[model samples]
Target chain A: MNITVLLKQVPDTTAKITISGGKVDENSVSKWSMSPYDEYALESGLQLKEKTGGNLVAITCGPERTKKMLTDAAAVGADTLVHISNDGVTDSTHVQKLLAAAVRRFDSQIVLCGKQAADTNSGSTGPGVAELIDAACVTLVTEVNYSEGKFSTIRPSNSGTEKVAVDGLSVFAFDKGTHELRRPNVRGIMMAKKKQVESITSGDLGVVLDSSNVTLNSQNPPPEKPAGQKFEGAEHVNEVVSKLRNEANVI
Target chain B: MAYEALDFYDVDSLLTEEERMVRDMVRDWVDEEVIPNIEIACREGVFPDEWRVALGEMGVLGAPLKGYDCPGLSYTAYGVICRELERGDSGLRSFASVQGSLAMYPIWDFGSEEQKNHYLPKMASGEWIGCFGLTEPDYGSNPGDMITKAEDMGDHYLLNGAKMWITNGSIAELAVVWAKLDGVIRGFIVEKNDPGFSAPEMKGKHSLKASVTSELVFQDCKIPKDRMLPGVKGLRGPFSCLNNARYGISWGALGSAQACFDSAKDYAMSRIQFDHPIASYQLVQNKLSWMLREITKGQLLAYHLGQKKDSGDWIPEHISLAKMNNVDIALEIARVARDIHGANGILDEYPIMRHMANLESVKTYEGTHDIHNLIIGRHITGIQAFTREA
Candidate 1:
């Protein structure tokens, strides 16, 4: 059994982002952390490896600075790591192409990626890779069990989640609805000092950048919104529920 | 800015990867499990004993020791754990440090193999609670003049002593008691079940209210002949344990100071006065900047000392120096932080007053602030101050 997980280092969602020359000014970003949804993807990959008895490989696409996420992945039990160093990658389709080429090199039987990279919020990579590679794709998956060339998955549906079983090659992009993110313990961190993250260039992975696929769009900060309604006490429970059900359409 | 709002020096970069991992695990656990419920415990004057087993499961009790089922984290990691635990509440850190450095360190350092086999594993697991009884009712700054005595009998020693200001005293099942035997001081393992041993809770302490304070009483207490620690003699045995506990206090006090400074920074930034935020005032900036500067220095001191401990060349005076300087500075920071919070600080809704109160006890215990000064004072001068008196 083989599992390949995709992770991205993004500016924290709460970081104050600023734009210069139509691109994000890195100075305003307070810190870079692993995309929250990617943690779930890595956790699922680790759990699947635990159950099925195989190796786990974490792969990421970014500059040399992103190597910390690779080492951190190794600290949390990734058997090996691949860093696709390419600073010019921003297109979701290009990410899919580069990832598909790397996944082919590993002959990865199952692929796991975050549903979307938080920085861009363009959630096309997982399905994009599945489309380019011609494999079964499962989106917004929360739980997975793999054995004997098959996968049992749980993903959110209309009203609730549904369990779906599938066989053969597949891709699963995750949400944090289930599976608590496991922090790397001290022993694992000590072990990571001996493990190394292998580097592979995007060019070596046979990623041909199609210039036609690249497009520059307008970039602006999200608009400010009105304050939310606050309801307190047991007496307002019905009113709160009514607002949620009718006004906000949450319930 | 980096989670705690006081680490302007990026102290986390100085820690090893394992140390940082241990710190984050304990810090997150404290934020989620300890902080929300601690104010209630402090206001009601009760120790949150419920977390003891959870702490054991987290592998923190006796975590730095090499064996006896201990976790064996590096000394720096242990210090980070103390820092995070005390950031929640000092009482919790007191319980853990007493269990690890004070109670368990001695048995591992001096006890017989039989004694270690009997108690170390259970104590490490929090299956059994233990307390140290070095600070007696009559001896606070001068433990050498302790009147507690253990007279030798053919079968056992009859012990008579009273240990005050003992943490975890009333609740503990065992105690490592320091008493005189054959006109020389020795360490004895006294079980609470011993016929003449009793521990009663000391009451009405305005400071350290969230921790268990008690008086350890021994009236003709009988112990088996083999229960005495066999590895070392005299004050050397207990003094080593005190050094370890004091090292932890140097780091733990910084946590309290950091928590207070964090609250003060947040309060100053938000509280409106004189038609603008109070943070815009130069005086408020002066206090906040000083606190940040002092907290950074204290953290660096502890980090380097922790490294020295790891390399096994740590001078004993450095422990006293750190305990003296860090606690003194921390108490000052806590006071200023309370003033920054103003009326809101005196209430339990904020931790400034609680930490302010706990630090008062921290300063006096594990060797008082002045006692540490004299310890350092003697180290440089080759003179003993307390012994030369009278």
Candidate 2:
């Protein structure tokens, strides 16, 4: 079996951000690490490759700096890397179409990606890509087992929980708890510097889409939540309740 | 006794595979060479001189300095080596510390190009022993009060001073001595064969017994003017050396505490108390848990500080905090570990007593607990609390 894990390079969540003149201050934003959920996906891919004796390919779509993320994944035992370079991936549909077209280029058996990126929290891209490719899609899978050309996955559902078993050539949106991410040792990191990374431009795919419709509408800072309101003591509890009931009219 | 999982704590995470390999190499060396003979060496109150050449052969001397056949390793790697070395005995680590951090670092950092080319490679190969002379009889904590004077001669400098509590002083071929010249502190590379230079071994030290500690005396010792370190002036040179040594101590103390914790934990699990293993008791579990927590915290602190040092942005106050926090916790862990061993704790056959005694020196040397607290105080309050007037 051949496994391909899709990784994305998002700004580290711990990074402090500043917005001035409707643009992110790049100078203030320091790049320190990969996304945590994507690390889990990479770990799952490596484990699957280890278990099934298959080739693991890590794919990413971003600017040039995304190559570092791909290289990091390769250091953790990914066999190959496929980088799809473009700057206009804002919506799920556009990213899905782009990844689907790239996936068709490789004869991969199973595809995997994180349940959601910490940056956008859209949680749509993996399912969208599976839909576009017309393959069996499972999301929020916390555990995975593959044997005899069949894949079994478990995920939480609104009612309780659900289990799905799909045949070969499926896509999975893995949760963070799926597996422990292996830290690349010094030797592995050094070896990663020598691995081959193939970069493909969207133009090379021979498919043209209307990118103007996918253009980002000015990025803005997230709105700050309101500060907590403090009540003095038990004596103020009734007063706060009355205010909520009468003035706020919630009761 | 076998090592417990908790004894490793955050140690493994902080090391790169290369650094871990270096650590494992040193660990294997200590287990094979030092641990078996440590008690005998301590009883004799002398470090085996043969191990000096052996450690030199193992590339443990002057590891972090770049160029000149030194290991040229990352600062964190040096810290890991120190930690592992000190785990066997502080005496062994002290020998390495004097050669590496105190002696070689000053030369690498402040010496002239000529000085580095001549001394670093020889020292790296362990063909020579080196020691630092900074602490004076009158000035224990207050180095600025040093009255050691260096007068200018036509072709050589006439030096007059006495440095106490110098490590490896008796056997050192090269010495970096700090003295006041025209009311300015300056560093000079003094050779042992100089006409007026003498090093006498200090006697009757209960702690760091297996290590050599001595006093250096210079009376009209004529040193060539070229030997003066031109790059550094005043107390900065020696203080910087202390900062480097203190960073290693922060990690090394953890090694000692870990050994004690492992020994105690194993004893608790195996040694029967009232027909059951003491480890089954809640009190023993509490002691074990606390040791683990403190060791883990110290490990994380040292690892982060090592990263900062590697990045070339470490400050003295950061090192002070790590040293202060780690040594304090290590001492506590040693005490609790001793208690967990009960009667066996006081025996020299066990490591708990030796670790407890050595931690006393670790807490005092480099910087005392109160001194480090003042350092942190100055960093936090923007005030110099160490000075009486300030």
Candidate fnat values, all? 0.24, 0.00
lDDT of 2 by residue, B1-390 (tens): 223235345567657755755665577567667888988998999989878977776676887888877777788988998888888998888888889999999999999999999999899878898999999999878889898889999799999989999999998999999999999999999999998999999999888989989999998999999989899999999999999899999999988988898899889999997999999999999999989888999988999999999998878999999999998998899999999999989988888888889889889888888999988999899999877795
Model 1 TM: 0.87
lDDT of 2: 0.83
lDDT of 1 at B252: 91
Model 1 lDDT per residue over B149-209, tens place: 9999999989998999999999898999999888788999998899899999998988887
DockQ winner: 1
User: What DockQ class does candidate 1 belong to?
Assistant: acceptable
Which parts of model 1 are misplaced by more than 4 Å?
A13-23, A147-149, A210-220, A224-251, B1-4, B44-54, B57-63, B67-69, B113-129, B151-158, B170-173, B191-198, B219-226, B387-390
Model 2 chain B: worst 10 consecutive residues (lDDT sum): B1-10
Provide interface RMSD per model, one decimal: 3.9, 12.9
The runs of at least 3 residues in candidate 2 whose Cα sits more than 4 Å from the true structure, single-residue gaps closed, are A1-251, B1-11
**Residue-wise lDDT of candidate 2 within A1-251, one digit each (tens)?**
67888888887776667776777766666543466677777788788788888888888877787887777776668888888876655566666777887777777878888888877677887898788778889888877788788998888989977889998678899787646555553335446657878998767765565554554456698899777678987889899999899977999
